[model samples]
Target chain A: MTPDALEGALRRPFAEPANDRVLDAAREAFEDVGIQRTTMRDIARRAGLGRATVYRRYPDRDAVVAAVLMREVRVFLTWLDERIDHIEDPAEQIAECFVAVVTGLRGHSLLNRLLTLEPAAALPALTVDAGAVLAVARGYLAAKLREHQQAGRLRSFDPEPAAEVFVRLAHSMLLSPPGCIPADDDAWSRAFARTHLVPVVTG
Target chain B: MTPDALEGALRRPFAEPANDRVLDAAREAFEDVGIQRTTMRDIARRAGLGRATVYRRYPDRDAVVAAVLMREVRVFLTWLDERIDHIEDPAEQIAECFVAVVTGLRGHSLLNRLLTLEPAAALPALTVDAGAVLAVARGYLAAKLREHQQAGRLRSFDPEPAAEVFVRLAHSMLLSPPGCIPADDDAWSRAFARTHLVPVVTG
Candidate 1:
């Protein structure tokens, strides 16, 4: 898909405005205060909606947080899909995808704030829902890896596990970045991917 | 070092009995309640020591908790050192280390309880001190990778970044394990290291 197509998809209005507003407000509040401290009333106030409206849309704070995270993942995948679909080489595609994700997440304001200001509250949401979240990412990568394998562009391996490692590595770097690697630099990501990621995925 | 030598080193008693007792008590108290809820009084009572003695040993709850965690890390590293010292193959050594860590952490009662019961409290300790903790792990791995590179057992690559990736991957898996890969299984860990880790270190 073209970048314009991806942007168009992202720009499409949510079917439920109240839900979208609640999620946006929750994301902002989560970044500002934290998940544990943020209340439904605060979210409602931020969204410019009544408590009843917020309640009707999201049963509780967890629901709103989950919605926000799901939305973030969807947006990230859309952005990634647009740029990587045309890359023919499996290693290059995977490398580019990793670089894009690291750079994209590094620049993301809410995510960066959440990790920095409120890690305790943020970590639980990520850890407990890790399986579900990783399933989405693994599915995306596994499908791509399988395609490459079938086309003789990648080596034989169980794409699911390989993709799982890739996704886990990305999540780890994104959340608790070990500054040992230059994650903010795209050249570093590509070189690191060539030595570390490509062999894992293709071998 | 031989197994017996390692055991002998571990058998050496702590320099200060009061410090050891207080730290042990703090760990238990943290596990029983939580970091936020556990008080100096609770720790003193758990240690079977008077309030004055506990105060003299540790000024506050945070100090006691930090001491406990530092001691725990030291013990874990010592134990790991004993097990991995004899393995000559860099790949095998690294794989065994990862497997040992995953398996050891899975069975750690206090850590598991803390993570499961009071993630909001436990997560802060991990995240706030992530730099210090990763530095220790990264330093150890980088040293090993460099030694291997010098010995011609590993290929030419920047060892620091490679070590960072290795350590980060382990930390991520330890905290929020992805079920897509069976990290707890020894055979699986070995296979994974051979395919993924060996290449990263030796490429």
Candidate 2:
């Protein structure tokens, strides 16, 4: 699939239940045996679908992995929207968003397994090959920042750069997880966002 | 070497000219043929040292690579001290430091070649196995931040976390440069540091 189509699928709710089943099976397989050991046949077997059926939908294991990851992003985005939709202050929204994303992803079983068991396989997707993931996240954040700007709740500067910074910071924290940051603590995350992150957009 | 010994060696100015020759040779070999292709014998040959001598100093190729990398960090820290020594304002010091580090490493021939030609091999030392590197950088930045704090030029905060943030951001940019940030531009990096990075410490 094209990048735009994949992005669209990521943003929109799952329209195909069959695809959801495949993604679920793939995620389970990855979590169980890790990405290195998981295969198309395994995913198909877990999903109770024929190998040809799974292959018809996803051309290869990589495609299936990408689809599962995209689905996870969509799920996280939906959860983020629900969690932060009620916060009135843009700064608070951003802070809570940061906390939610860091902790949420940290708690994801499949992601945690992949990171621990298959760092070489997983690191590239989250780091160097993360253009699509970063773009989706940046888009989501920029839109929220823009909304706040239009409402006069946020100071007017280019939200795109600020959003990108936030995304990169979160990305780095999740991937490397510095020993210094209390990334798991909600209170610390909020205070940190207020001090370091909110100012970029507010300035 | 013990971790403490490694840290001490990284901080101290090069004392052994013979080891320096070995490192210089290893760097040249790494640059010429890449890390995977360059063996300890090649480094020894290039350094005009016997294989037994090289093996005596460094138990294996990884040890030599680590030592060479540590030397690079020392070189960078010395350069950073010289670059930002005269800046009175803590914020400007931080900004210039950011610019110097990001641009300097980006321009480093060995690091650039490794990143471009051998990402899989180069990435771990910079990411998951980057604790030592990150710790050294954090120590440098934290000490600078502490100096400013004591001088009343910056606000009181945990400099370690703030320093880690700076290091991690630079790490992320170097590893997976986002499209939105003009990371290579000095002016842009300065502005970004001023807006986002400075506040974490100053606040």
Candidate 3:
């Protein structure tokens, strides 16, 4: 399917009170305390709803945490796919993708809180389970590379190896970020894209 | 200094019982039980020594843990340095370093034990002040890069960026190693060297 079609599926209104309120409460509770420490009652209290009501929405802490993270992951990937889908240049596509990614992922206030307050609880959700959460990123990047190759804009490089490098680089950035890369980031995005990405992907 | 002279000046037997055996005991205890849960008695039991003896050698668990990590680090770096110093090609040297590094580091051994058994206790010692680990690695890698530039085997690439990439890639290998790469062995060393290392380093 085209990027347009995939993104169209995610275009939803913020008009639904219960779903919005449930997510909002989960986000607030997770931010104030953390994923592991926050109770269902805490979310209920923040949302000013019954504890049973919160449980009805999210059966467990892991489920709540995953829901929050999953939303962020999906939005981020969707933004990337929409942003880069039109860019014809492989180097530009990569550069724009990294910029959109670092900016989009880092700017999410909930993720920042999750990473900051309780990395122990949150890191596995993001890093491990490579099969689940990060598959979006891996698949998105791989598809982009394949598009570049088919367009004849890319050099003699395999999409899969390039994807491996990209994913691993993202993982490293997530863990021990460098000061040079503005936590408001884009510094390493330029560095990586210009120096490494262009050379590897371009003819 | 000449290579031999430098080697001689740097070399020492820090293998004194207070140092080596203390570190050895810490490693063994950390290996068996969790590092946080393992007491002085546990270390003493592993070493077949008294609690007083363990304390006499190393004052506390943190010191013992650091000492143990430092010893292994020093040996690993030395082994890396020897390989780098012998290579005339900068690309080859950098590739060798990555291979040695991935081989030395990628495993569920030291870090996996730390993460699974005792996350709270081991996090600090893992990153906060783990000897002069990065400083030593950067120095050795920079020297190798500098030598390679002089020989005109590689283009004028910044050693700092090269070193940064090296460390980051090694960290990636450790965190989410490729399926092909053996957990305990460097069997995939040549392939990784050819694919990832050579592409990045060869100017």
Pick by TM-score: which candidate is best? 2
Error of 2 at A29 (Å): 2.4
C-alpha local distance difference test of each model: 0.74, 0.77, 0.62
Q: Which ten residues in a row have the lowest lDDT in candidate 1 chain B?
A: B1-10
Put down candidate 2 lDDT per residue, A71-165, tens digits, no spaces: 78778877888999788898889889978987887787777777767877776666676777777777777878877878899777777777777
Most accurate candidate by DockQ: 1
TM-score of each: 0.84, 0.85, 0.74
lDDT digits (tens) for residues B1-203 of candidate 2: 33355447565647788888899998998888998898998999999999999999999887887777778877887787899978989889988998898778777788778877887666666676667777787787787777788898877877777777777777777777655877578998898778866766664
lDDT of 3 at B33: 72
CAPRI verdict on model 2? acceptable
Fnat per predicted structure, each in turn:
0.60, 0.42, 0.12
Q: Which stretches of candidate 2 lie over 4 Å from their true place?
A: A1-10, A16-19, A47-60, B1-10, B17-22, B48-65
TM-scores, chain A, per candidate: 0.84, 0.90, 0.73
Overall local distance difference test of candidate 3: 0.62
**Quality of candidate 3's docking, in CAPRI categories?**
acceptable
Winner on TM-score between 1 and 2 is 2
Please state how well chain A of candidate 1 matches the true chain A, as a TM-score.
0.84
Model 1 regions lying over 4 Å from their true place: A1-18, A31-37, A45-53, B1-19, B45-60
RMSD of each: 4.7, 3.9, 5.1
Pairs clashing in candidate 1?
none
Candidate 1 C-alpha lDDT tens digits along B29-72: 78777788988888888989999999987787656765676676
